[model samples]
Target: MNLAQRINAFQKLGIFFKQFSTAKIEKHSNSEINTLFFDAFKMQIERAQEFNGWFTKENVLKAFESWSEALSVENLIEWTSKYSFSKNTSPKTIAIIMAGNIPLVGFHDFLSVLITGNKALIKQSSNDKHFLPLIAKFLEHTNPYFKNKITFTDTVLTDFDAVIATGSNNTARYFEHYFGKYPSIIRQNRNSVAILTGKETEEELALLGEDIFQYFGLGCRSVSKLFVPKNYNFDMLFKAIYKFNNIINYKKYENNYDYNKAVYIMSLFNILENGFVMLKEDKSYASPIATVFYEFYDDFDNLLNKLNTEKSDIQCVVSNENVVDFVKFGQTQHPKLWNYADNVDTISFLLKL
Candidate 1:
C-alpha cells in the first residue's frame, strides 16, 4: 500500500480497537474480529483449567487492554512517525529472534518491521511458539498483504539485510559472532530494576506488581531487582504483591520457577522466598531464576555514581522520575519502528547500513 493508504489503514485499525469497548468485551466474551486474541484467550483458559497456575481472567483482561491501548493508531503513529522508513531506506528482509518471556513479547518488532515495508523472518522461541502465529493470522484477516511479509521459521538464516536477536548473555556471544558482520541489533541479558524512594503508596505498590509479576517476571521488561534506600523495609512492598502469589506457577512456568528456585536455594542454602522470586543484595542487574536481589543506598549522589558506573550493563530502570534520559521501563515498550532495544539508536545503525 502507498504511504497514504497505509496511514489510513492504521487509523482504521485504531478505531476498530476502540470500538471493542469494555461493554463489548463483557458482552461478546470473546474477541471476534481479532481471532488471534481469542486464540490467546482460549490458550490461557485451557492452561488455567489444566494447570495449577496461570494468569487470572482479570490479569489477562488487563494485558489485553494494555495491548489494545498501546496498539491504537494514535500511539502506533506517534511512535512510528519519527522513523517512517522511506521506501528507499527500508530493508527488504529483516530477521527477528523474538523472546517468549511474556505473551506477545516480540509483537512490536513484527509490527514495526512489516509496517515499515520489510519482510520479517521470525524465529520463535520454543517457550512461546503459539501467540505470534495467532496474531499473524489475525493480521492476515485484517489485510492479506501481511501474509507475504511475515514468516516464522527455524531454518538456517542467511542473506538478511538486517537482524535483531534477543537472548541471554551466553547466547549473545553466539548472536554477535554470527550476525555481527551485518547491520544488526543483538540484545543480551537485560533486566529492568525499580528504584524505591519510600514515598510510594500502597496503590503504587500494587501497580509495581504489574511491573514485576505481570509476565511472572519472565520478560526482560519485568523488574527483576529493586534499588532502595539503605535499610528499607519490605513490609509494604511484600504485602502489596502478596496477591500475585498465584503467578508463581502454570504448566510450563511452574517447571521453570521450581527448577530455578531449587538451584538458587540450594546454591545459597536458603528456602524459597515468599514470592516467586528471592530478594538479596547484589551489585549486578541479572538475577538467578525467580530471585531478584536489591541494593540499598544512603544517598542520591551515591546512587547516581552507581548508575553511571553500571550504565553499560543496565538496560532499563523504572522510576517515578526520569532517572536517565535514555533508559525507561514499566509499560513503555511501545517502541517506534526504529527504536532498537538496549538503548541502541537505530537511526545511527541504519546510517551505517
Candidate 2:
C-alpha cells in the first residue's frame, strides 16, 4: 500500500483501540471495526492476565489509552511529516524481536516498519504473544494491503533483511551474535529515572506516581529511581503518591512487596516504607518491583554530569529541569509517537533499510 493508504488504515486501527481505552468499554457501530473486533478484544483483555499476571485490565487499558492518543491523525501526521517515504522503494521484510515486559510493548517498532511500507516478520515474546496477532487481523480488515504485510512466528528468524530487537542485556548478546552481520538496532535493558528538586507540588508528585507504578514498573519507561536533593524529606512524595496505594491489592505486586521488604529487612538496609511501596537509598537506577531507589544529590551540576556519563544506561528522565529531551512527570509511559525508545529513532533507522 502507499504511504497515505497505510496511514489511513492505522488511523482506523487507532479508532478501534479507543473503544478499549477506558475501564468502561463502550461498543458502537461508529464503524465496522467496533462490531467486528470489540467483543473479541474485550475477551482478550480479560484473559490477558491469565497469560501474564502483569497485564492487569487497568494497565492494559492504560496502554491502549496511550496508543489511542498517540495514533491520532494530528500526532501521526506530525510524526510522519518529518520523514520522506518513497512509494517506489522496494519493500523489505524487517524482523522484530519484541519485548514482553508490558502489553504491546514492541508495537512501536512494528508500526515503524509497516508505516514505512515494509513488511514485518515478528517473533513475539511469549509473555506478550496474544495481543498483536489479533490487532494485525484488525488492521487487515481496516485495509486489504495489510493482509500479507504482517507475519508472526515461533521459529528462529533467518530470512529478514534487517532486525530491530529489544531484550535484556543477556538476550542482546545473543541477538548480536546471531544478527550482527545484518543492519540492526538491538536494544538492551534501560530504566527511566525521576529528578526531584524537592519543591514539586503535591499534584506534580502525584502524577509522578504514575511514572513509578504504571505497568507495575515492568516497562522500560517506568521510573525505577529518584534523584533528589540532599536531606530531602520523602514524606512529600509519599503523601502525594498515597493515592496509588490501591496498587498493593494486586496479588503479583503484593507478593513482590512482601518479598522485597523481607530482603531489605534481612540485609539490614535502611529503607522507608509506608505500607505499600518501599524506598531504599540505592545508587542504582533499575529498582525491583514494589521498591524505588532514591539517591541524594549534593550538587545539581555534578548530578547532571553523572547522568550524562551514564546516559546509555538511562532511558527518559522525568524532570521539570531543563535537561535536554527530558520527559515531564507523568508522561513517561505515555510517550509520543516520536519519543523513540533508548533515544534511538526507530523511524530513521527503518528508513535507512
Candidate 3:
C-alpha cells in the first residue's frame, strides 16, 4: 500500500479503539469495520484483564482512549511528514521486543515500523500477549497489504534486519550483547519525575494524582519520584489525591502497600503515608509500585543541572513552568504521536532503516 493507504488504515484503527473506552461507545456512520470487530475486540479487552493482573478494564480503556485521540489523520500525517519514503527501497524486517508494563506499550514501535514501509516481527511480553495480535488483525483487515508485513513470534526472532527492544537495565545489557551487530534501538529502565515548586493548585495536584495512579504506576511515563522545595507541605498533595483511594482496593496494590509500609517501619525509616500511597525521602528515580520517592531541592539551578546530567535515567519531567520540556500534570500518559519514547525518534530511526 502507498503512504496514504497506510495512514488511512491506522486512522481507522484509531476509530476502532475509540469505540472501546470507559465512556459509552458511540457507533460512527463512517466506521464500517466496527460492526465486524467491535464485539470481538471488547471480548479481547475483557480477556486481557484476566491474562494480566495489572491490566484492569479501566486502565485498558484509558490506553485505548489515549491512542484514539492520538492516531488522527492529522497526527499521522504530521508525524510522518519529516521522512521521505523512496518507492525503490526494499522493505526491511524490524524485530520489536515489547515490554508489558502497560497496555499496548510497544505499539508505537510497531506502528513506526509499519508506517515506514517495513515488516514487523513482534515478540510481545508474556504478560501482555493478547491485545496486539487482535489489533494487528484489525489493521490487516483494514488494509490487506499489512497482512504480509506484520508477524508475531512465540519462538525466537529471526530474519530481521534491525531490532527495537525495551527492558530493564539488566535486560538491556543482554540485548546489547545479543543484537550488537545489528542496527538497533535498545532502551533501558527509565522513570519519570515531578518537580514541585510549592505553588501548584489543588486541581493541578489532583491531576498529578492521575499521572501517578494510572496503570497502577507501571508505565515508564508514570511519575515515580518528585523534586520538592525544602520544607514542602504534603497536606495538599494527600488531600488532592484522595480521590484515587479506590486504587488501594485492588488486592495486588494493597499487598504492595502493606509490604512496603512494613519494610519502612521495620527499618525505622521516616516515611509518610495516606493509607493508599507512601512517600519516602529517596534520591533514586525508580520507586516501588505503591510508593513514590521525594527529594528536597535547595537550589533550582543545581536541581536542573542534576536532572540534565541524569537525563538518561528519566523518561519525562512533570512540572508547570518549572523546567524546560516538562510535561504538565496529567499529560505524561497522553503523549502525542510525535512524542517518541526514550526521547528517541522512532520514525526517524525507521526511515534510516
CA RMSD, predictions in order: 4.3, 1.1, 1.4
- Stretches off by above 4 angstroms in model 2 are none
Candidates sorted on lDDT, descending: 3, 2, 1
Off by over 4 Å in 1: 7-63, 87-91, 248-277, 322-340, 345-353
The C-alpha TM-scores of every prediction are 0.79, 0.98, 0.97
> lDDT at 100 for candidate 3?
97
lDDT of 2 by residue, 18-82 (tens): 88866578775646767778888999999999999899988899989889888888888999999
Pick out the ten consecutive residues of candidate 2 with the lowest summed lDDT: 22-31
lDDT of 3 by residue, 188-268 (tens): 999999999999999999999999999999999999999999999999999999999999999999999999999999999
Model 3 spans > 4 angstroms off: 26-32
lDDT, candidate 1, equals 0.65
* Candidates ranked by TM-score: 2, 3, 1
- Write down the lDDT of every candidate, Cα atoms only: 0.65, 0.90, 0.91
**Model 1: per-residue Cα lDDT over 89-192, one tens digit each:** 54578899987665556776676566666678999887666556766666666677777878889888866888888888888899999888877888887777
Query: Candidate 2 — which pairs collide?
Result: none
